[model samples]
Target: MQRIDRFTRRSLLKSLGVGAGLLPMLEVEYAQAQVPAPRCAFIFCWPNGMLSTSAATGWPAPSATAAGITFKAFQASLEPLRDDLLLLDGIDYRFLRDSRAPENTGHACNPGMLTGALFKAPGTGTSSIVAGGASIDQYIGSSLVNLGYRGLPSLNLGVFVKSTGRLSWRAAGDAVIPATDPYRVFDEIFKGVPASGGTGTPTPDPTVTRNRSMKKSILDTVRKDLTRFNLRVGTEDRKRIEAHLSSIRALELELDRQAMPPVVVGSKPVLPPGVNTAISENFESTTNMMIDIAVAAMAADVTRVVVLQLGDQGNANVILSTLGYKPAGQVGNTGNFNGHHAIAHRNAADKDKVDTWFQS
Candidate 1:
């Protein structure tokens, strides 16, 4: 699974562009206070167990030294992020695996990864396995709420998660299915939030209503200014601004690929309907869009805790495209093998490709 967090930032700006993007644009805006950043956590999960670089795979084993974490060979794509990587070597979801979920260790251990409890594997099949307790993200969210943190208690988002991909749990037998559609997830998290970024319920005003009809995306008005600013700024600053603008484009995507208005000022954000999130090739944008929305939600204080699962432990639905390198029998995508999960169980050598794709 491509880490969506690594792919978005402009969403943070657009979602905040009016809501908090600029106090000057919106009549009401969040205080630009420099309070201590809220304590938050994000979980990015994938299938086929913890990926370990074994000698058989011909990849250098990951290790952490005094300097930082190291990933050599097949995992070299992760070199730039070595310092931030925490590679746990001996961890396993064995507590419940040894008890209730011993039969189908892969699928049964899914709930145990987050909840640390004996998962419920109803009946004889692993398909019905569910978490027996709340996941850590939920636990932390509750603690944050208790500490007076506002917005959503937590967020559960997913990319191409199928029925077997259950992860975050509110309680035993009560699985919190992740929101896969980026548009829906955005609405769920940012619906009630006024573009001002204020917490109070917004009352309708005729002036504000008229402005909403005339408003286009903030980017439409700022492109030339950004370009002029880009030419005056240093190389690094220019790159940062470009990335920011690129993210805004991603966040503003529509079915017709039109630019969406930044969260409407003085009112709820109204995104256009008809987002085609079901197309296979469109999954990349969908995944990245989800990241952009999730990040914006956190940055705008819509939510503090989020769980972004690409695919469940046993149901890795991501396709590892070889780009131009198509080997025999590897039709790719959903052709020969459906996705990573199938490749994992069918071909051992190809498993590294999945890891490599994600790391890249």
Candidate 2:
């Protein structure tokens, strides 16, 4: 495949002998190509089921020391990230509230919560239910992709708890399928060419190299056929072929960018302990890294949109550990709690612990 530094639809039509009268269609393609891509990203920071209480809710009684700074229980843990977040309160999930059907209250809630349709539990029977409705992210992703943003619509990432269940959900409310392994995510971000420069079509893992070759081969086949068929084809078909070939060339150029080497995952000299020890110390560090990756992807124009989930629904206990609380056994058996959802069931009297947990 020929490499492209600058591409224009007029040049393409001239090479293919598309008629001068068809210039209007080429003008539309040129306009789209000249426009810069728009970028949008969202991160879902699920610190597990919250210990919602008065201290976690209403305005805290004013402090004598600072006028504007009011401190609540959960609000304190968020102090560091306060400026970066928009905390919305009292919005209800009518789907979960109104439906009498059994909701997948744990990790199951992760998908359904956004999809707005009740997602069938992973292994429960053969059929799935409408957990809620199509989630906002899914709707946006589909719309963007359809609008000619061939760039990745979303990058689904995670620290642990692998599966499609971690990153995102489809428009139909099915799991969006995530890349739990950092390396795989990296590959998906950049799949063609080589780690170093000078384009001899650099080497890659078998699958990676093969996918690239296959794409090129198919495009080559189309280009050859189109060149011969253009004389016989109608104006509409010629225009369609011209537009498609342009898209294929643009995609190939994006693949070339992938040849750049990946940045190493972590900067530390030694690995930390626990679930994310292999990646980083705890949920906070892992999440921060995930954000960095997403930002880079956006900056590189790799994707127009991304959905980042902090952790799985019921099993996301890393935040508990990241916030500096004991994992097990303590006064009131507080630290003994394993999962976040399990801890959220506490009554109002346990406000202190609940607030402490969220503060983490």
Local distance difference test, each candidate: 0.54, 0.47
TM-score list, all predictions: 0.59, 0.52
lDDT string, candidate 2, 36-67, tens digits: 43436544535345544455554444332333
Which stretches in model 1 have alpha-carbon errors above 4 Å? 1-35, 54-64, 72-85, 191-275, 316-338, 346-349
Name every residue pair that clashes in candidate 1: 16-21, 17-21, 19-195
Q: Report the Cα lDDT for residue 286, model 1.
A: 64
**Which candidate leads in TM-score?**
1
What would the per-residue lDDT of candidate 1 be over residues 1-360, giving only the tens digit for each residue? 111122112233234221211111111122454455544455667667534544434334443362443345666665655544443334444555455665666555666566656554546566667766666666666666567654566778887777663767766655667888888566544554566543454334444434333443455566657877888999878976786565444223311111222222223344445656775444555666776776666556556677887765654455544332222343343333556666677657566655555544
Residue 283 lDDT (model 1):
51
How many residue pairs clash per model?
3, 14
At residue 164, candidate 2 shows an lDDT of 33
